[model samples]
Target: MRAPLKLYLAGPDVFLPNAAAQAEAKCRLCAEFGMTGIAPFNPDLDMARPAAQLWQEIYADDLRMMRESDAILANLTPFRGASADAGTLVELGWFLGQGKPVFGYSNSAVSFAARSRAQPDDALPGTAIEDFGLADNLMIEGSLTLPLTLPPDGQCRPFDSLEIFQLCLEGIAGWGQGFNR
Candidate 1:
């Protein structure tokens, strides 16, 4: 039997209060879809260490996980800002750089342009937002050829919702023997 594909889970969910729970749930879904999910957290890492040293270790550790995975499943859901989490983008880019398969899902079906409302403290006021009809940035969707995965009702789901996440895994499973998993 073919081995299961190892998928690197990327997103800002690592910063969430329920991070471990979220990762466990995702891992369970991955197993059902015939793949292995590797979340970003490392329980062995000492959190009480110096801030700078700990952060560096985290960066190295996550990269190590990505190196071991066969593909990446990124949560493109927007966090505090308008676009997807910056850290997730970095992980996606890392997978893309290695020519590995990259898949993504977002809870928000709204275009990034629509979400890019100008605020008084905006860094670049009057800057035209790109409206290419994409869930996030052009570079992201342009490379992945991924359409926004939304619920059957075509409505936005919550950040932690796994409805679309399963859809993404199904899409990956639909790839069949291509993954050799």
Candidate 2:
């Protein structure tokens, strides 16, 4: 039998208090969808090191995992700021650079412009908010093969919502890519 597709699961969930739990849940979902989910973090990394060293090790490990994956499934929900997590974007870019298919989902139903405050008197003045009426930056939006979004009336979803993530899986399955279970 053929091997299942390996997807680099990119998102801001790694910084959450329940990072491991979220990863496990995502992996389980991926299995149900007949794919292998490769989350960015490696719990086996040695944490007993200097801050810089540990960070460097993490970066290297994440790159290695990304290289081993077939494609990326990114969570493009708004993070600490008004945009998706910067690190997740980097991972997506890495895959894109390699000409790998990229998929993503946003728990929010709101458009990027609607969520952004770009009026002249806006508290976050000066820089112009990307008002393209997209779920995220135009570049990211255009990169996705399937950018699943929540229902139009969906409320503010937490960073870890899996509703749209599952939608992404379904989209992949329906793509007729001949994945192996």
Candidate 3:
């Protein structure tokens, strides 16, 4: 029998108040879909180390996990400012660079240009706003192996919402089936 696909779950969900719980929930959903979800925070680092050392260890460990995964499922919901989590984007790029399949979902219904523009016609100061009607940056959306389609109603939940997360998992599972063939 084939082993279940390992998916590196990348997102800003690690910053959520109940990150561990969220990870568990996502893992459970992955299991339901015949895949294993590896949340970025699943590793238990030694807290006794110095703060800087611990952070470095955590980053290294997460990268190791990403390298081992079969593919990546990233939550591209706008974070901090008007873009996806910078760290998550980096991970996604790393996985893409490795030639692995990439999938993403964004909770925001707004387009990237709409979110970045200060006003309807105003650009992001000096930078040009891409009017591609995509969720985030074109490089991100263009790299996705599966399209992120919103529900018919067009309403989306928060980053921690299991509903949206499940959608991402389903996409990964479907992609995996085709990928293995």
Candidate 4:
């Protein structure tokens, strides 16, 4: 039997309880589609450390998963409209850097550019306005697009989570096939 496609799922953890729940749900769904899901939100992982250290650990953990996994599924939803969780972003980048396929969903009303616009212009001299607008992965804007199919780098999709999952599953299946070739 073929090994199940291992998916390294990435997302924000500021909403620890909720984020963790969502991660598990996604994992189960991936399994339904014949994929194994791995997430950083697992209880065994040490995520309560200092920011710097936490990031280092997260990078290491995600890198290992991406190296072994078939693809990635990321929740691009902005936590409190700030942006997709920072650590999740890092994980996404790591997977993309490895040329792994990525699929992400954003249920956020505010775009990354909008968040920067919301900040007071004088808030910081060198503040880099981070835009959660686009990433290397597939942006699932399922509900946000409604009957219309928006381009990959378009607006946010309020109801596109399911579509995102389907797309990611397909992408992962295809990616995994490449590995067997």
Candidate 5:
């Protein structure tokens, strides 16, 4: 039998207050679908290290996880701004560079253009909003032919909402099955 697919879970959820709990929930969902979710947190890291070293260690560990993962399931939900988390976007690019299957979901149902327009005038002056009806920048959305997994009701949800997360998981699970065939 084929081994379970290892999926790198990329998102800003790690910044949430209940980050560990969120990761555990996500991992459980992944197992239910025959995949392993590798959340960004590494419990083995030495927390006593200096700030600089901690950052470096986290970066190195994340890169290693990405390399070891079979694919990436990214949360494209906008966070702290009008776009998805910058770190998650970079991770997505890295996965794409590695030629791994890329899947994404957005907690927000709003189109990228709408979200851009909602940004403060000074935030995106003279920026042309691309109207592809995608949840994020065209470069990110254009990489995949498949539409991003969204909430069934077509409404926005909290970033930590398991409902939407499960939708994304289901989408990735389906994609993985077809890919393996």
Candidate 6:
């Protein structure tokens, strides 16, 4: 049997519980496809550490996993805006900077300002799609591709939402195999 492909999942650990479920489903899908999957699971206790130390640990672990993986799957769901989790965005940049293939998923069918409860003091007052683009930066340079894995409108289903997960997995597997050549 062919070896499993290694996937690196990126998302917000602070606010997105759905990210964890997505990661798990992706891992399971990878296994089904005979590919290895790697995802970071930051528990509440991990968040209890000092901010600086916690960041240090998180970055280190994420970096290690990215370095060891073949590709990345990122959740571009906005935490505070129409883009993605800040940490998730940062890691997406890193992965792209490394020239790795990137796949992004998001429910950004709406504008950023529309999603915000209140404008930040530093808010630029612009659209989220314009700020973040339709896809992650790296994916544009032939390194990534943004595919819609969720409905454009309405609430997104949970990670245990098997149908969506399977769809995502199938896409990833196809992508991985395409790049494997």
- Highest lDDT: which candidate? 5
Highest TM-score: give the candidate number.
Answer: 1
TM-score of 1: 0.94
TM-score of 6: 0.68
lDDT of 6 by residue, 32-53 (tens): 8766778876553387889989
Q: State every prediction's TM-score relative to the real structure.
A: 0.94, 0.89, 0.90, 0.61, 0.93, 0.68
Q: Which stretches in model 2 have alpha-carbon errors above 4 Å?
A: 118-126, 176-181
In model 4, what is the error at residue 51, expressed in angstroms? 9.4
Give a tens-digit lDDT track for model 1, residues 1-181: 8889898989988888899999999999999988999999777799999999999999999989999999889999988877889989888998988898888889887778888863243677778888887788899886563554656566899899989999988888887457553
Query: Per the 3 Å backbone cut-off, how many clashing residue pairs does candidate 2 have?
Result: 0
lDDT, candidate 2, equals 0.83
lDDT, candidate 5, residue 81? 84
Q: After superposing candidate 6 on the true structure, give the runs of residues whose Cα lies further than 4 Å from its correct spot.
A: 13-25, 42-49, 111-122, 125-143, 146-148, 152-165
By TM-score, the better pick of 2 and 6 is: 2
Segments in model 1 whose C-alpha atoms lie over 4 Å from true places: 118-121
- Which candidate, 3 or 4, would have the higher lDDT against the true structure? 3
Estimate, for each residue in 27-121, the C-alpha lDDT of model 5 and write its tens digit: 99999999999999877899899998999999999999998898888888999887999999999999888888888888898888898888888
lDDT by residue for model 3 over 92-134, one digit each (tens)? Answer: 9999899998888887777778787844445435767688887
Instruction: Assess each prediction's global lDDT (C-alpha) against the native.
Output: 0.85, 0.83, 0.83, 0.60, 0.86, 0.61
Each prediction's number of clashing residue pairs? 1, 0, 0, 5, 0, 5
lDDT of 4 by residue, 1-181 (tens): 7888787776664246476666777778888877898866645567688988877785676677778776667766665545556666666666767776666655544555766677567757776655545332223332111221222455556532555555556555655665651
Q: Which residue pairs in candidate 4 have backbone atoms (N, alpha carbon, C) closer than 3 angstroms, thus clashing? A: 112-132, 142-160, 143-159, 143-160, 144-157
lDDT tens digits by residue: candidate 2, 55-168 = 999999999999999889998888876678899999989988998889988887777777676234456457767887687889988887766555446676766778778878
